[model samples]
Each structure stands twice: as structure tokens, then as C-alpha cells.
Target: MTAYESLGAAVRFSNVSVHYPESATPALTDVNLEIDEGELVLVIGRTGSGKSTLLGTINGHVPHFTGGRLSGRVEVMGRDIATHRPRDLADVVGVVGQDPLAGFVTDTVEEELAYGMEQLALPPATMRKRVEETLDLLGIADLRAAPLRDLSGGQQQRVAIGSVLTTHPRLLVLDEPTSALDPTGAEEVLATLTRLVHDLGVTVVIAEHRLERVVQYADRLVEVADGRVRHGSPAEILADSAIAPPIIELGRYAGWSPLPVTIRDARRAAAPLRRELAGAFPTVAEVAPPPDAPASPAPGVTARGLRVDHGRVRAVADVDLAVAAGSVTALMGRNGAGKSSLLWALHGTGARTSGRVHLADGTDPASLKPPQRRSRVGLVPQSATDLLYLDSVGAECDQADQESGQPPGTCSALLADLAPGIPHQRHPRDLSEGQKLALVLAVQLTARPEVVLLDEPTRGLDYPAKDRLAATLRRLARDGHTVVVSTHDVEFVAIVADEVIVMAEGEIVAHGPSADVIASSPAFAPQVAKVLAPVRLLTVDQVRAALPRNAI
Candidate 1:
């Protein structure tokens, strides 16, 4: 018999508290949570709020792998984590971390998927069958031979998930599994996971910031904040949650008791609100420059015949586009639609088979050196940690200040503004995913570049941090700094993007105002837009602004 087959609960935490070395506060404190067999539980919280720490304890990574002190009991499948290390529970518990690239052990997609099964001593035929099943399940069958390093961030995330799913563990712990996926891809993965829960009786626990996508599949919700956890049904926790998805926010704004967690629920509850807003048309005007600002601030970025080739694959193909000055532009598409390749080519870092990219001064970014290119166009890639190598957050900020020729602590101030409460002495790699992204963003902005590019910037950020980032991007536009963001977050686009550019198969398929484009497209539409259809309203803030003071 298997080691944990006799256990009643899939996971159990008994008054668990964790303290990391040299840290003033515990990562998790007085936390008591339990997950039963065949349950799909979602863990929700802000960035750096101990959601990851709680997930780590499931497989004994907390005090064992993380070198922290544990005061209470953590058991996975009734196996005591104090005695069972991560490897000891590997057969029954599988984990996919926030950064998929970091966890990869093989070079190719097929190899990675088979590696875990090999470790379990599964027969070759079984491994082959499971590998093919997982690849097709995650829709990465065509990328089976593709190198893990060359695949898009979303593709890597799928491969990572597939790698774990191939193991067929009784319990699965996923951290931001769908954070890198497009809307459709996310839907596919979540549907597959829900099937696993219903059909196979697998227990799944997920921690995600994009709750709009996964909340519908949750059997229960666990809220983690300040090292504390609150567990209940989705409606029970989100009814009064300060950090909520746009759909939940809309439900709460309409004062719907038992707030909706799904699009259908919100839409059903929004009929009256839709009637109230029937006559109102929401429009997002470009942020106007200050009166004292220069009349012709600067020319925005323009590219003609841009093409990026990766081996035999043509990632970006002859894309021609122009970004207007003092405007926030959002580039969006499916997993391998060349958004990252296009952004890198624009930033003068990625390969360009043939293209002409010109900045404000009619200068080609590709023609400039590294430092000059950074000053002209700054980029925060999908792997935000690639830019961080310093020992501590303070050290990284100081280096950015020195390299960018900015005054000391300039980057530090920006970091504080972007994500507050990040300890200066903490190592860059040790910080949470959102915290790392914030630090890299601060470093890039220290150069005061004319144009900024961010790829999936909201992957790890909570709603509050996204609000801060949106405000920062809007401020950049108002200051005549062109900002371009490649993301799958439709809600964020509705809030920050003045113009939306949709790419498909490496070509721009649709380009228009955010409301015009997203409202018309079913796949890209935000939750509020989906709920309050026929009104052209894209955000809860827009709905609130259009209504009377007490109407909401």
C-alpha cells in the first residue's frame, strides 16, 4: 500500500507557525488549515503575504528546504513533514513554483515531462502514455521538441504544470500556475484541473492573484494575510475581501448579498445595474499633458517591417506599428503570438532579421550601445529576476542608481513607492515574485527612459500592487513618457491602457481604444465588461463614476 493511502485528509496543518532566520517576523503564524481528498482549494493574498510559505509547508519545504524554524505540525497525507522531507513526499505531493524556468531539470518539453515519472520508477510505456496525455491536455503537443529556454513564458508555465501533472500525485500544489497564460489558455488549464478534481479525485491547492480566472473552480477559499489564514467558501471570504477580482468588486459595488465569484453569477446579479447604466457610455480619454508641458513633447516609438526569427520559428513577422506619445499602450495575444519577441526587438535587445525602429529623436534603438539603449528605451522582461544579481534589495537599488547616473537612493524611493514594506536587507532572489518585479521596475525607471516596455508585469502582483503600477504607468504617460505593456490581464488593460493592440500569429490583428477593442472581443474582455455588456463599461471604477453617489 502507498504511504498516505490510509490518511483521511490530503493535507493538515496543526497550529503551524514558521520563522525564517534573521527575519523579525514569522512568515506564517498560528495557521491552521486542512484540505481533504478530491478538493480544489485556492489560496488568496497580497504579494509577500505568506501564501507561498503555507504552500511550502505542504511538502516539508518550509523548515526543511527553506532552513526556517517550525513550531507546529504540518502533515501531508498524514505524513509528518517534520520527519518527511520534500523528497519523501514526492510520490504523493507535487509542487509547481511561481518561476517555472527555475524548476526545470530537462532541456526540452518532452524530456521535462518524463523526468518526474522517471524519478517515480514508472514503466517506460506508462511514462510515454502519461507524457503524451499531459502534452495534449495542456495544449503543448506541438512544442514537445521545443527547447525549454526558447518557449514563451506562458508555454514554459504550461510545461511546468504538465511536468507535475504527469506524476499523477494525490495532492498538487501550484503557485501562480496560470499567471503567465492567456485568457483562453488559462481557461483550458483550469478546466483540466477541475476535471482532475472531479474525475480522478485529486486534491489541488492553488495560490493565484488573478482570482477572476480560478475563483470559479475553487471548492473553497483560503485567505492569507500578515501570516494568518482564513478558510471558508469562496462567497464567504470574498464578500468582504479588501483585495478582490473586478467581478467581485462589481458585485460588492452593486450591494449584491452573497457576492458573486464567477462571471455568470456576476452577470445574473448585474441585470438591474446594467439597466441603470444602459444610457451611460464609458470612454477612456488619453491623459492630457500638463498645461506647462512642452507642446510637442516628443515623438513616440515607430517600427516598420519588424521581424524576429528564433531558429526555424518566426516569432515576429514584419510587424508595423506606431505608439503615440503620452499614451499607455497594451499589447496582448495568445501564448506564442510574439509579444515578448516584439517587445525585445523594440527595446533593441532581441534579434531583428529586418526592421527599422525609431524613438523620439528619430534614433534607432538597435543602433545604440547597451547603456545608451537603456537610457532611450527600458525593458522589464518576463523574467524580472534576470536583471537582479545583487545580494540585497538595497544593494541592487544602489547599483541601479550608480549605473543609471541617478542620485543615490533614487531607485530605493521608487521601490518604496511601487511595493512598500520590502526589507532593504533582504536578498533579491529571496523576495517574492511580485517583490522582485517591483525591484526590477524601480531599477529600470531610474534611467528615466523615454519609452518603457513591460512583459507580463502583473504576473505576481496583487490588486493593490497592480493599482499602484497602473497609477505609475499613467503618471509616466502624463509626463510624456511612452509606456508599452504586454500582458494577458484584461482588467489591468481596462484601467491603464488608453489604446489596445492585439497581435495574432506575430501580426497586429486589432488596434483601437481599450473599451472599443476589449468590449468587442469576448476573449479579451474584462469581468466587468462581460458582466455589464451592452453598456461599453470596462471597469468597476467607470461604473461607479457613471452612477450617482449613493447608487452603488
Candidate 2:
């Protein structure tokens, strides 16, 4: 047995099966696994692959929340999950789910952070102390008085984590906690997790689709597919995993030994390979076609003097932005900056006061019906799952295509665009968070709208999902579809956005090319952008290209 096995099994499932009330098949089937104390393990799979179900099972949520029939034993900290209530497991196991907004029970950050502690009936003084400690631990002490809704997506998520941390549970489970955060916010959350695992000796289990960020940090890797654990590792498991991170995939394609796990490792592994294959190196300098001339109306989506009022607060006032038909526009802002509100306005769902908004190339700005909007703009809402309710992935795609009146085979075509040759019959929601995101994207693209608006597309996606989404957007822009994403993923914006718009207190503070805007606003920039600032490179590929052959 290992250190994990020796910790008396923080979680144990033996021949576990879960079947929903109306479902014919089991959501989870005959599964067995063990996670011990002080271990940091990563759980990964496409949506509906049982990742969330499995995580929920550890706390008795499987049968309780979904009216599911569960068979077999699920033991968490020596307690049977099925017999114990979710509230019972709260003391030993802390869960920070993907959606922060849904998890919050209190209006203010301080109260929200203290709620878990209060649930355990901790003394008021103790709860207060724990709340302050947790706030400091996550580095969000200043936002304690802030309303949960007033904070940015990233800030809200951090508070959620702080709430769970205040309980000091032995096992910390996070399901895509960093999904809604920008690069900087993501780093902050990850850093906090790292500290908890390293300094406090807490057992951490994180189910995420973004493998790159956590792969290097994870002590163990668990991969699930078809509602079963397919891969486990002490030795590296990247080569055998279908959803391996980009650097690992790149290494596998290049046939590097001991498959690299991190970008630095990939760099070192590729150094000699590049030199050895210099004479036969494939030309990678294929520049995209020159951008089309700025049209009479500027060939873009431009919002001038836009104003949006949020209750008594004027969230976004006098904002100006432009997104070209063949380019990406990134909306950058701190929490409560009205980024989502602006995206909603553009999607014809928000409060728009005085502004002249235009969709260049003859796109009608007045049409508000679903059909009318489908022809001019495709929207992947902030929560892509808000639109998904089908029984399976194939069904969801078909439904999207049918509703949008896109031709048959549209979903399969979009799948091919995301991951060539992947099966279409798989459950759409069963895919890993990243894969589910891809399906939502495919569904959106089926409309083939000239302009695409995504609100926080990268939220809750693992690194793999982020990279794939970024690549897909780049390709879409290259193909001349206007792409506008309102996001906190600064690295994503830095890599793909031709133009950047900064929204602060519901007003446009800055607008320019991505490079100039990112340079001027380092505080809101991506981690990589901040790290490589002054030198300036966006994507990882750019960083690789700019490096000297022998730099590694």
C-alpha cells in the first residue's frame, strides 16, 4: 500500500452503481477506487462520464439530489455515503463545485465564507476567526464585505473556496473551481490549492478538464471514460490517456522518450529533436491570409457610447468596442466590471441604454427573435450547459441543429472541426468539461452565424479544453467568422484576440490591439503575458517560435 492507501482511505467505492429514477442505464457502473488522505489526485473525463457523479457519491449526493438508485458501498472517512446525509460528510469532505453562483448561500462574502463553519456549530468567535483566516488564505480579505453577486467570476469562486476551507476538512474536492477565472485568478486559486496540499497536508481531489495546469502538480492521475476508471498512474500516464495535455500530445506526436508533461519539459525534450530533424523540419511559417480590408462600416461589430444600468448602479457607461468579422475581440475586466452584462447586451438579452451598436457586413442589429439572431449571431452563453438537456451528446447536437435549422450532419461536422474522427454517438454531457465545452461550441457553430459571442467560454474547462477552444476560435477567425468572447482567460485573449476591450465599472476604459491593451494593463493580463511582458508573446507556440534553437 502507498501513503494514500495507508491513510485509511479518504474515499472508497466498491462495485458502485448509480441509476437515475427515469433512466434505463446506470450513470455510474460497477466502479471501484480508493483515495487516501494527504494525496492530491486529479479526476478527468468527458461530461457525463461519471466524474461529477463519482465526486458527488463521495458525499451521498448521487442518490439524494438526483433520485438515483445506488448499489454497493461508498465509504468516505470510514462512513458509508449512502447511509449518511450530505450534511454529515461536510465535516470531513469539503466540495467546491464548478459554479460559484449556485453554491453561495449568503449574500456577502464574509457570511458566505462563514456559513460552512456555522453549519458545524462552531462558536461565533471561532467562525469569525476561521473566516478571516480563510479569506487571507485565499487572498481575498478585501472582498469580504462585497456582495456575492457584485464580485467578478474569479473573485466569487475564490470566496466559494474560502467558505469550504473555513471548515478545515481533511479532504478537499474541487470540480473545475478555476473555470470562471482569468489567468491571474486561476493562478491565485491554484496557488492556494498548492499551499493547502503542501503546507497543511490536506488530501485534494480535483476533477478538471484542463490538465496542463494541474498535471505537473498532481501526485496521481485518474482517467475515466464510459463511467469507468480507465487509467491510473504512479508512472506517467499521459501517453496512454486520450485527453492528454497539449505539450504531452505534442511530445507523443514527435515520439519523445519519457513523454514530456510540462511546457518546460516539452521544450527540453524537443530541443534535440528539432536539431536532429533540422534538415527535414516541416515549415511552420504558414501565415494566415492577410486580414480583409477594413470595410465601409469597418467590417466588424462596434458598440459606441453603450450604457447599461444595473439596478441603481450604472455598470457599463459610455463604452466603445469593435470586433472585426475575421478577428477575435476580448472583453477584459475585474469582477463586477459588467463584462457579462455587455455580452448579454450584445446577445440581445441585457439592458442597453444609449448606444449605437453595429454589426458590419450588413448584419441587422434590430432582430431579437431566436431565428433572426441565429442568422446574424451565434451565442454560446456564459454557462453553455444552460441550453443542454438532451439524454446524450448526439441527441443534444441533433437538437441544436434541428432548432437552428442547420443542415443535417452539422453536429458531426463541428465535432470533426474540434477533434477529427471522434465518435458522435458518445454522450455530449458525459464528455470531460473540456469536451462538453467543445460540444456546446459545435452546437453554436452549427448556426454558422457571421458573428459568434461567447461569455466565459473557458470557465470550468481544464487546460486541455482551454487549448482546444483557443485553437478552434483561431481557426474560426481564420475562416472569417467574427468571434467575440467575453472572458477572464487573459492568456486566451492574449493568444487569439486581434483586439482587446477593457471594461471597468461598466465603462470602457481602454480599447486597442491585444498587444497594446495587454501591455498597458498588466494587472488584468494573463499569467504568461505577465511573465513574458516587455518581450511580448501570446500563445505557447509564439513563445516557442521566439525562443532561440539552443535556448532550452
Candidate 3:
């Protein structure tokens, strides 16, 4: 029997258009779609492409909390969402938003898990049972008592899911849920969600960027573009639609039919091509980074036995870290693992930090004035727009140059080095996520501070943008500006960092060169390393070179 016949309609939208009160552009327009029970649909789109808005409509969040103008009809579980309040719809639909921090309500995992059931007025016994079941399903049972603030990013995200699932909703909608998770964490979450669909008959719908990871699991593929449902399908949808992964794009570019959906399928379809292309093997030439310029003999920044506290909680403790005259040190941990607090402590942002944080001339970071500290160190906040308050990209860079006392347009030129071909006159908000990230990187690099700290700089960028950012970072390191970045993207660390510091439970558990540390650790390891098991090959080129010449 068809899913529609078996479980009824979980979600249906016909000619749905959502327009915000103050916005000229509609968030979603003329969208028509239906999700049947026990069906898993993959919604693919770039950032700000209305995927979030469409997903939000399933539970009446679009017109309710957002106060958007809604046209057409939205029905979930055969109930009209327009007539129902979000709280009413919450009973049938569980949503995990892109920002996990936004969805959290309580302090501890146990409290958060119990929140939905409490809202629904469930009995204590029922709530307890549901919370435990959700925790076990998500594999976060060990963290039941942990504070929401103390959990890793992946763990925190899982907790967000657990909180939502406590309601026992028939429909689950996930928005970029695995964006910040490591491969293993992502795998675990996806596996759990998959089981929930197959075993419990929950309807699953997720919007994500890493399509290759979830495409294989989705029963239906939905493409959203220009604020409309451009296409849909089980077989022909993927075959005819434009929504697919990078490797699929590569295959399409090379004119491969029956495009591979997953890596295994890709491998099979590519075997013949590999045989034909073996003689013409593509060589990934090592782009020798510019020669290491001798750094001026000036102290950059140093942290000696540093410890940070959040009230009674210690986010970072007894961590000795350093950034020399010119280098990049990447700090990696799961979310809520003290990376952000450490970055703030290094800059002395009024956070409670102990031990010693020093700049040039052995000056204590905590003692330095704000202006003096800023001149010596630059911080690019997670949101580039947070640092940008200008009209145009060029103007923002110019402002950074003036504030830093550098030559006019110096920051703009730095941006050119980081991301060429970007128009300076364009509004910073109009740029792609990667270009925006590049703009911030350029602004920070222009200050030419002795030390620079980037927090999840590549959070929203695509693969190409990531590659460009990685290249620019290497150039920055080689040029002698000590760099520190905290991120969840292990693939990025594998490519750029000279040193990788792994933190867990507010303490530095592992620290060493990237290759060695990533090779040894399971939590912070890169995707390439996992694929080439036993060996610690971090980059694709490394794997390519390591493969025996005759392996193909």
C-alpha cells in the first residue's frame, strides 16, 4: 500500500505563498507539495532559499510567530494549520530548527527533554517515560543530567531533537540539523532518524546542505529554488532535477547517465570511466604555498595554563596554548566544548579567565585596555554581519582600514587576495555566504594584527568557498600572523591547520600536529582519514597519492 493510503497525509501545501510584512521579496511563493506518512523527503536549497520558511509552515509558524502573509492552504495530519495555533500544531509536528540554541528552553538535558511534555500537560510518569525513550533513541542517555550549556555542539543538537520528540509527534521536520555535527555525530543522528521513520512510522522531512549524506536515505527528493517547489520525484525527480551533490555534479559535467546517488554507486558507475581515464589520470598538483616569510622577531600571543569559568562552570581549564610570530592554530571541539569561550578569553572579553594571556612585550591580555587590545588582536565574530555595519563591501573594508590606522582601501586589497572577482560596490548582505565570510576574513586580515582569531569562519560556505578560504588561511599563516580558529568542520582542519587542539569537558584532552592528532583521535578526525582507515590521510590528495599506483 502507498504511504498516503497507509498513514494519511502528514503535510500538504497548495499554492502556499508567505510574504513578510516589511519585506518586498516573498519567503516562499506558489509552493505546492505533499508529504505522505512514513515518507522521508529531502528538501535541497542554498541558504535563504525559503526552505526554512516552507518547513516552518507545516506547523503554522509562518503566519503565527512570524506574522507573515500567508495564502493558499496548509494541512498537517488532515488538520488545517492556519486555524490551529503553533502550540496546537506542536502536538502533531516536531521541528528542529537550524539554530539549536534558539530552540532550547531549560538548563539541563533532562529538563529540556521534559519541557514539551510539560507544555502538553502530560503526567509526570508519562513525561519521564517519553524523555527516557527519546534519550535512548538519540543515543544521549549518558548526558541526561548534563547542562545544556556544557554539552558538545553535536550532543546539544541531539538534545534539541530529544526535546522535540518528547511530544511524540507524527511528523518530524529538521532544518540543517547536522550542519555543525562531526561525521560520526551526523551519522548517529541520521541513523536514529532513519530508524524512527522505518520503525515508528514517523514522517520525516529535512532541509540540508550535505545532500550526499542524506540523499540515499530519502524516499523522495524535493527541490526548492527561487521560493518555489521547482520539481519533485522518487526516481525521475533526482534524474531530471538540478538538486544533487558535488560529486553528482562532477558526474553530470562529465556526461554520466544514471547519475550515482551515493559514493558507493558513484564508485560503481565510475569504474569504467576510471579504466578509460586511468591513462589520463588527473594530477592534483601541490600548490606550493609561498615561501615561508621570516616573521619579525616580535612576540605574538601566548596562553599559559589558561582557565575560563562561566559562573561556577569551567568552560576551559588549565589549557596551555600559544600562537607564535606567524602560524595557524585551529581549536576543534564539539559544540559547548569551550572553543568560543577560549577565543573570548584570549581577547579578554570580560569572561572569567585565569592563568596568563599575553600579547607582545609580555603584556598581560587582561591588563591591556580595550583599544590597545583590539589593535594588537582582531576578532571575526561567527556572523560576519555582526562586524559589518557599512553600506557596501568596499566601504566596510575601508572602515576597517581606517579604524586599524592602515592605509585606505588596504582592507579591500586584502579582500582581493582572499576572494578575487567580488564586487566591492555590492551590499555585504547580498553576497553569498562564502563571499560574506571572505569579506570578514579580509577585514580582519587588513588590520594585520599580530594575532587573529576566527570562530567557525567556514560555517555556511560551500565546498569551493571552503577550498578558497583554506588557501587564503595558509597564505595568512605563511605570512606570519598567528591565527586561532574554533570550528566543528574537521575537513577544514585537515587542510589548513599546522596544530590541532582537541578539547572535551572544558579541558584540553589532546594537542599536537594536525596529522598526528587527527590520526589518533576518533572524535575530531577528518572524513578522509575515516575512509582510508588505519592510515591518517587527511586530504583527498593525500589519499590519492597514498593509493598504490596500480590500485585502480
Query: What are the C-alpha RMSDs, in order, of all predicted structures?
Result: 2.5, 5.5, 5.6
- Deviation from truth (RMSD, Å), model 3: 5.6
- Model 3 CA deviation exceeding 4 Å by range: 1-7, 21-24, 139-152, 231-300, 309-317, 324-326, 335-337, 350-354, 380-448, 460-475, 494-499, 504-552
- TM per candidate: 0.96, 0.77, 0.77
* Candidate 1 weakest ten by summed lDDT: 284-293
Instruction: Give the top-scoring candidate (TM-score).
Output: 1
How big is the positional error of residue 53 in model 2, measured in Å on the Cα after superposition?
A: 2.0
Scored by lDDT, the top model is 1
lDDT of model 3, residue 405: 88
Error at 184, model 1, angstroms:
0.5
User: Model 1's lDDT to the true fold?
Assistant: 0.89
Model 2 lDDT tens row, 50-108: 78888888777778875778899988888887778888888888998887888899899
Error of 3 at 447 (Å): 4.5
| Model 2 TM-score, 2 decimals | 0.77
lDDT (Cα, tens digit) per residue for candidate 1, span 27-46: 99999887999999999998
Q: Residues 95-120, candidate 3, lDDT per residue (tens digit)?
A: 99765766788899999999989988
